[model samples]
Target: MPSALGEYFQDDDGSLPEIELRFAQPALLVAALEYLFGLPGAYDASRDTACVWNLIHDREEPYRSPQDARRVASGELAAFHRLLRAAQVDGCVLPDLGVFVSGEELILDYRMGPQWGESEIVALLRLLARLRKRGAQVAVPWWGESGERAFADAIAGIDAGRSAAN
Candidate 1:
């Protein structure tokens, strides 16, 4: 549900990479992560803060500006913080876990920062495995006959209302 995804710096400038996923149940996403990673890959309290790619800030270390830090007060952001804390994913009040949404079509997003690597995406596959276990519908936009295109085509026939034209 978090659209307009971007990576603006303290000076408000950026075009970094990001990730998104749709799951049926919100908690199931965490459950999936916990089932696979054992630590709910979203937030590790002992590590960082502000999950959504750690809340878009300067790419450099100490990546917080006065204005950016103020966002910690937003209701949406604060709710996510609370959820992680309650889950005991970490002790940090603002653990920079990944990002997520538990709604009609549960969505998970991640802003791959400057240091992203191929290995990081392996975690996503774990999520796919967990989703299959829970019977949650997945919408992966990949390629080839066995990729995103075929998945979309298959769903488009069964659930035209939910499928995209593309």
Candidate 2:
């Protein structure tokens, strides 16, 4: 994390449970990041796959065709996740956000402006839910609220923090 990263993961609600993906465990790390790249709007698999390959100790990247090789790999998982967080589609209120994992913490921030609506937060939550559904370690550290309510409540808390700051 750097001083400039301050704008990316700005202090949201303390209740906003910071996402943490266990990279030390390669299997979980690969599964989660690949799952994220395949989400509706985030389509950059080849690049992400390369980064994932670097994480696996006993694996080599499967051979790729010239076209597949054309995809410039992301510098790291954090950069790839940032691209996904910023992706948007028509009729979808995908938050203009950023994702970066540092020192085991996968940080998600809803940009420096624009309070996200409940539905938008839920959309993002659903992607995370997918990871959780797969038995991945998607821990909601203080969010004991359960189901989608936890995420909505977290976003609401973040909005309140933003309001207080202004």
Candidate 3:
């Protein structure tokens, strides 16, 4: 059996365990998600995460429309779930402090930075809302200064809305 980390890069079965999607810029996150799930021949389970990372990092243009973005996000989420099922993994292990939904949790690890803009924040919140509707909890590992505070604010906003609803 291949290691979980190794399975991502060398399984050769063309199926991946989990994808550690990374985004250096906010605008790319949606596109990355879409490519993960929509673009044909974009993700190779047997390949390393770097391959997928490179593909997104190397893209030259924005998505054609909001519908296209949504399609990609849906596809990526589906692929993520499939990967988890195939590997019997609980959830994805993210590489950066960004919004990612896994299993029953919407996780935001803010140790990376607080450089995200309003659009990214709104998009992430929308994603988290969808996850919550599907019975997932939202969590942030680091919520202090640096990038943590911003993350905390985001979580607080979500929590407050949830609280108000209850």
Candidate 2 residue-wise lDDT at 109 = 41
TM-score computed on alpha carbons, candidate 1: 0.35
TM-score, predicted candidate 2 vs. hidden true structure: 0.44
Full ranking by lDDT: 2, 1, 3
Worst 10 residues of 3 by lDDT: 81-90
Q: Which scores greater on lDDT, model 2 or model 3? A: 2
Candidate 2: where are CA atoms >4 Å away?
Answer: 1-17, 43-81, 85-93, 101-105, 140-166
> What would the per-residue lDDT of candidate 2 be over residues 101-133, giving only the tens digit for each residue?
443334454443234544444455455555555
Best by TM-score: 2
Best by lDDT: 2
Give candidate 3 misplaced runs (Cα > 4 Å).
Answer: 1-115, 144-166
Question: How far is 50's C-alpha from truth in model 3 (Å)?
Answer: 8.3
TM value for model 3: 0.29
TM-score of each: 0.35, 0.44, 0.29
Tens digits of per-residue lDDT for model 1, 72-121: 33322221311222121222121123433333233333334533222222
